[model samples]
Target: MLPLPESLRPSAERLFADRLGLAERFASMLAEQGPERGLIGPREVERLWGRHILNCALMADAIDPSARTLADIGSGAGLPGVVLAIARPDLTVTLVETMQRRATWLEEVDAELGLGLEVVRARAEDLHGVRSFDVVTARAVAALDKLARWTFPLVADGGELLAMKGGSAAEEVDKAGKALAKLGGIDPRIEQYGVGEVEVPTTVVQVRRRAQGTRKGETRG
Candidate 1:
């Protein structure tokens, strides 16, 4: 098992609080099984705490306190999905992955952690029109334009898509402008979390779905 660095201990405690042990166990599972299962690269094991776990845990801060449902698309290794569920027990999280092996691993983690996650083995596009959630998120999935096409429809009216991104966040958002406009996404913005806690803060591109009856390009009053 990869050891949680002391440097990250305070951030972990701040994010997971009483659930820190569960986070530790999940980290152990990932460190032990992730590379062998192809869920994460072998190189990732060394920085699992900073680069993966805590990086994901901090996104919990961006989530709306009133949001009750969330879905993580392409939730391979359950980055923010499992991490969010562990952090906010109040949320009903669904992990959506098309790959059989990754979905199976998610199920195993859910069962092991008793997180009550709904693991769906289907592509994010498949759920369009069939299901929606208060918040939809994805990490390391695809570039912003294509990702918005797949995930924005899953965002319920007035809800948001909180996509984890990298330095290219602004570039991606600019590139996705047309797609966002057509998809009824409004006020797209980039935000960072865990500043001062981690060596690098997590960058997120947040886009809210226009509420029902709101026309595209119409400002909210």
Candidate 2:
């Protein structure tokens, strides 16, 4: 099993609980299939717990517990998608990757981890009218402007787009202002979470869609 930090153990135990076994299986998968499929760098295997798993899992704390549907776009290694599924069983997480290899790996991981997630092998733009979800997430996918363009259409009215960002979270939100508004997003804000847990808290650019009443007759952009 990958070495989890002592400080993170209790939280992991509580968050995972009955699914702890699935968590271990995921760690092993990242160390094994990850590098072989070029999902993660070879040197990253050792840092999987802190850098990948925890980094992604921390986003769970930022999401609303009541959200039922979540889509992770450009889910190369299922960073936040698979981790979120392992952390929150109530959420129906979908891993969306355009590449066949990554999508196939995600399907395999989903079945092995028994997370019961959906794997969609299509670009975000193609899924515009096909479906929508309560929450959409992406990590290191693209610049916020481009990300907004790609994902904003997939968010259901009254739902949210939670993009896991870094130091540039605020800047990206600023840059994405026009695109976000054009995509029917409102109330864009940067929220920093995981304080006291990870040295640097995870920063998320949370953008909420207009209320259904306000978005009447609005179609995907």
Candidate 3:
């Protein structure tokens, strides 16, 4: 049994209790196989509970209760994608990774965890016209500007892109303005999120897609 930070324990218990022993199983896999397979760094094993798993699981708090499907772009090692599925079984998650090896690892982890998430081996841009999602999630993937270009097209009308970022989250949002405008993204703002499970709050930049027929840089005249 891995020890969780005292403040985070209760929340973890609540999140996992009804779901079975998911937390434990996920921790074990990450610690044992994650490093060996190069899915995570050797130094990351000790921090998996706090930095990786719990952090990603907290993303569930940002998801809309009515959201049915979520796409995790650049889902290397399934970060938030796998964790979110375990935390919220009601969500249909798709893990999109351009690397075959990473995609394979996602599939393996999904089967092992029985997460029921779909693993798609393609970059976000490739899937733009083929699929759309109610929510798009990304973490440590790219700068907000480039990320917006790749992800905004995949968001269903009225859907949102929730990107996990570090302390520079606000700055990223500011810099992504022009890119967002070009991509038809609206309301790009930084949101403080988390379940009180970690010492620092989770920072996310949320950008919503404009509803159909609404044009960016246009006014009803």
Candidate 4:
């Protein structure tokens, strides 16, 4: 199990309620998670409340107000996906995951909560159809370079890629430069945060997937 809230103090429960309004539902989901996964122990739930929920909500800073649909790849446990679904109901969130169990969990929760969402169970590459979204997001899924491949086609022209990266994201951005360019993403930028004591580092990675047939795909700084 993951660590509980990196820092749980006064006013945190309120944050949980505000940020994660459906705390009781989330707790119920967490209760079912480990047993469903068949790994049971003790992992602090508060930590997840702050680090995951609050941290995920921070992605909003990267998105354009025009964005209404978001695709969260590998949305295991629905950190950012579920959080976004609740926090921003205006967003038509698509939780794409290959794992059936996790997908079911996501689907069940969304259905139970009546949150507007579309859950797709398939490999990222296998996805087809007009699934273009305004924002494509991922957290702790793969390296940024590989992530470009994982997330590119899912984005429509003018959409953005929000990557939740760790400390020293600049190096990863450098490593992913070629990949992001190939995927028609540009103007990547980093944002730093601290979840209480733990550094909540991530990259907003504002990108405009260039229109096809354009000569210069990368958005100029």
Candidate 5:
């Protein structure tokens, strides 16, 4: 199994605290079974700690302290979803994946780690109007414009959509502005976490859903 690098220990220790072992076990499973199951590329095994686990864990810092529930859409290999559940056990975490095999794998990981995650096998759009969450998240799922359409509705009024993005975060936010307005997403901004703690900081595009009673397409007049 690939070992967690010594260089990243400080950051890992800080993000996970007492639950670091759970994160380690999850990484071990990813390194061992991820490639075979097509959940992750074999090349990713080498950097599983820095590139995947820690990267996801850093997002926990951006979560609202009052948040009680979160849903991770397209939680393939359980990236931020499983990682966040391990880090912040206070919040109820749900892993939503459209693929059957991936959903099954998430369920297995949830049971093995006893993380108590809700594994839902369906497209995010399918859950719209049926269920919602205090916070909704997605990583490498889709472009911001299309992603907003799929994820925004799942965010409860006054809740947030925290999308883990890459360097293009700003561009995506700019491009999704109109769609965001239509979806009642407000205060869109790019926030970075683990700036000094990690080699590469995690970029998150955060948007809050405007409260209901305000029409979707209505202007603030």
Candidate 6:
């Protein structure tokens, strides 16, 4: 295989050392799919490592290692979903995408990479599977409230929902608290981190489903 492009070596080395190889694979996959999906246009290939892969990886770090089943909504270009599956082979990921073509691309990537995963060509409302995942993650999808409504039900009674966001995650986290509570997830915690010269602004709106069901630090409201 060709050497990793010079531009991405720094980011790739960092991510790889962190054991986040999925980040690298997802960037390469986007480069491959650009011809067909048009999501990562030609101009994007060089920057995919830092902009896309690193951006998506921010969520993978927040996910507890204990999480088993992950449902990623609006998995366009398969952000953290595809990254998570590749990074953590032990974790089963169900990527939910409304667009048929994107889902097809995801399936193709999974098959080509031999990444064990499932892609569902369905929208949040159309999904009939109930409370079935250990974690639900949405990246740049709908607004926080809507994402809560869309993803929470897919989380099992003791699972959690995490919405990855930018800007003052504090404000957005507060705005979505009520919605989260109603869906069986507890209030969220704001996570902050940075990489290189770029400030990786991220907000994780995480709600614990329940605990019987309750893990320590997770309480029923």
Clash number for every model? 0, 0, 0, 4, 0, 2
Q: What's model 4's overall lDDT?
A: 0.70
Candidate 2 residue pairs in backbone clash: none
Q: Please list the residue runs of candidate 6 whose C-alpha ends up more than 4 Å from where it truly belongs after superposition.
A: 1-25, 41-43, 128-131, 194-202, 212-221
Cα deviation at 112, candidate 3, in Å, is 1.4
Across 58-132, the per-residue lDDT of candidate 5 in tens digits comes to: 889888899999999999999989999999999999899999999999999988999989999999988999999
TM-scores of the candidates in the order shown? 0.97, 0.93, 0.92, 0.80, 0.95, 0.82
All models, RMSD in angstroms: 1.1, 3.2, 2.7, 4.0, 2.5, 3.5
Model 5 clashing residue pairs (backbone): none
- Residues 1-221, candidate 1, lDDT per residue (tens digit)? 56789999999999999999999999999999999999999999999999999999999999999899999999999998999999999999999999999999999999899999999999998999999999998999999999999999999999999999999999999999999989999999999999888998999999999999987677565
Whole-model Cα lDDT per candidate? 0.94, 0.86, 0.83, 0.70, 0.92, 0.72
Model 6 agreement with the true structure over 163-190: per-residue lDDT tens digits: 8777746776787778877666665777
Highest TM-score model number: 1
What is the per-residue lDDT of model 3 for residues 27-47, given as tens digits with 9 covering 90 to 100? 787788888888899998888
Writing each residue's lDDT as its tens digit, candidate 2 over 119-150 gives 99989999999999999999999999999999
- TM-score comparison, 3 vs 5, better candidate: 5
Query: Of the pair 1 and 3, which is ahead by lDDT?
Result: 1
lDDT for model 3 = 0.83
Among all candidates shown, the one with the greatest lDDT: 1
Of 4 and 5, the candidate ranking higher by TM-score: 5
Candidate order, lDDT descending: 1, 5, 2, 3, 6, 4
lDDT of 4 by residue, 43-160 (tens): 6344555556556766655667888889999998886787777666678999998889888888888877777678999877876455788888998888888888878888887778
Which ten contiguous residues of candidate 5 have the minimum total lDDT? 212-221
lDDT of 1: 0.94
